[model samples]
Target: MTKLYCLPHAGGTPAGYRTWIKALAPEIEVVPLQHPRPSDDEPLSLQEAAESVVEQCETDEDFAFFGHSLGAVIAFEAVRALSGPPRRLFVCGSAVPPVEASRGRDLRSLPDREFLQEVARLGGLPPEIHADAELRQEFLPGLRADYTLAETYEYHEGPPIPCPVSAFRGLSDGHVDKDGLRRWGEFTTADVTAREVPGDHFPLRTSATFLHRAIRKDLAA
Candidate 1:
């Protein structure tokens, strides 16, 4: 059986990918990375986070990567960090090569109310949760760390990996555009395929069945 390692978006949990396993082909096993919450009481650099994900992979098997948002960046970096090639790489709901954001906005440093307001503006957050003080307090610190990790990532250009690159973006996603999404081709010598799914920034959760079929075709090809 081939393992498909799935990475989650910011503030995301394993439950998102766990849902996909039911839709995935039985031969393709789904392995969701264990993302650290901010409350883990330990801070990890972006590279360390990638390494943590890599350290968990089982050896002696064919495997591939499927990451969304922050997970996408980690999976991409982790693949480059490894000695062997994965069967394929699929980055969903993120820029292909990943563009850099402006330095020093520091969303993580804002006060709880202000920081959450910023998170809300980005979408993916529900209004009801925003209104709940207890829930907001619990979700804020961890989510802020995720946003900081992603925003602070410095993308250093190196030789592309040895597997095919398939990028899946959200048609309505405001975070990334098609040209940026298509740039993933430049990272790999293998043929790259870029296409849009139906939602924004989280199609992996919203469109798991569609993604399962798409992943199945990619693996079969």
Candidate 2:
């Protein structure tokens, strides 16, 4: 793919894609999608975020997509809303976007320290920062907002995206296994391929080379 749009994990900013961009072949251009935090001026639902992205995506480019964690689902929804589908769509570290209610601890509503501690346990925060009582406090709001976004997300009923789909996962991530990743095939009529890379959930955030490799395989196909 000549142009790829990248989306980030929960609590992630566009800067998270830098290493992923560099790790890719020099011929490919990376465009990171900057999802603004929900504001009173522009409160974003999943569809709203998708709409925002669709408006920015020009019809002429041979665009492909790669999104991790919450970004994966957002990208999925966004592709469905696009007038022209991308060449390929890659999703990692998530299940097929959840439409119904999910069962879990209500992390968003938990007390700050308790919530931060829980996110740490789930590998959301660095252990050192989670341990540093004062330092962890600084990350609370963004982290909470991200988790709340994830927890409350509901898929809209729509026609599936037409692009080829590829799913990737950290080998040991307890959040979603390889099978869950495979289920993404249900959302697309075109080819859906799944693979396992060596790492946990958070590594995909810092380790872009591996993610680049996974995405390149699809481009080569």
lDDT by residue for model 2 over 83-159, one digit each (tens)?
78898998888888863126445788888878876777786775556678776666666666667667767666677
lDDT against the true structure, per candidate, is: 0.78, 0.75
- Poorest 10 consecutive residues by lDDT, candidate 2: 97-106
Instruction: State the lDDT at 42 in candidate 1.
Output: 73
Q: Given candidate 1, what's the lDDT at residue 199?
A: 83
Q: Which portions of model 2 miss their true places by more than 4 Å?
A: 39-42, 99-105, 127-135, 205-207
Q: For residues 1-221, what per-residue lDDT tens digits would candidate 1 score against the true structure?
A: 78999988877777667777766758799888865544346767666788778888874589999888778888888888888888999998777534733334577778877888887888745455678888887777668888778767777778988889888888888877788778888888787888888887667656767788888989889
**Model 2 quality (TM-score):** 0.88
- Of the candidates shown, which would achieve the greatest TM-score relative to the real structure? 1
Q: TM-score for each prediction? A: 0.90, 0.88
RMSD of each: 2.2, 2.4
